[model samples]
Target: MTKDWLTTGETAKMLGVSRQHVVDLCTRGELTFSQPGTHRRIRSSEVQRLATSEFTREQEKSLWLHRALLGPLMLDPARVLQIATENIARWKPLQRGDGMATRYLEQWDEVIESGVDAVADVFTSKDERSSELRQNTPFAGVLDDDERRQVLQSFREHRQREHAAV
Candidate 1:
């Protein structure tokens, strides 16, 4: 059976540290553990949290940059366009790129002018054209497919609520 808790050695292996270090962490209460019988056990969740929490700022930055560079290649064009349009509409005036903001706003307007079918076309097409469109767009690469979809869905829901209140 799969275990929810890890033994001290298992936790050490997962964290890339020695068993003694894991023992020390458990002893110091830096890592929470349970003494079930004679052995110490660490919760798998706690190990995951500590591993993620221990990243340096530079490491985090490098990881995000790498994800951004790779993210767009995995996204659908329609989703990307919808995300871009929503983001542009919601962008604050104080943000950088006044000229670029106006241009993006104009593009958003044009997309709306073209109607839902044009947007639907983007969803249906899985061609190189769609990939090319995604590649040309800045900020499209910043979020991985799952993160982008979640953010876009959040924005879409927020916009629907705003429209409903009007």
Candidate 2:
């Protein structure tokens, strides 16, 4: 019966983890599998038994917190902020070592740097005014013919480039 089994991707979806995490579990002897041809196949019964047997306090808490975060609390900005802070705190300790922590630290650093670059982009473009102005603003009626022609020409060129791809 164990000859036909679920693939790593299938098991990962059922277990709510990534394919890499499943691979780690297999390597650590937490999960058992058989390599047939080009794929690793895990027995569903074994996975289910392991899932049911492991009921540690930390695991329970993690599940509950994960569900809560994905539910009604998802719309609450404060809750989102608190959860992000908790994740960063958990990540910091792991970051001190040269293993998974290092990888997480690098990912977090990139995320923060990208955010800074986005903010910088908005400020840099703020001073460069376009020909179009707000209807209620003082510059609404000041647009000249040449400025209007320049805007139309720019738009036409943009459309031409966009349609060329199709």
The pairs that clash in candidate 1 are none
| Model 1's TM-score against the true structure | 0.32
Q: Which stretches of candidate 1 lie over 4 Å from their true place?
A: 55-166
Worst 10 residues of 1 by lDDT: 128-137
- List, in order, the clash count of every candidate structure: 0, 0
Candidate 1's residue-wise lDDT over 1-166, tens digit each? Answer: 1488999889988877557657767876778999979999888998998787744232333333333434342455455556666665566354456453455455545653585555344323434333222322334444768876765566557557765896
Q: Where does candidate 2 stray beyond 4 Å?
A: 1-4, 55-166
lDDT agreement of model 2 with the native: 0.48
Model 2 lDDT per residue over 1-166, tens place: 3535888888877776556657766876778988878777899986786566543222332233233323323355344334444555555675446554345444444433455343223222222110011100111112246754654566557557765886
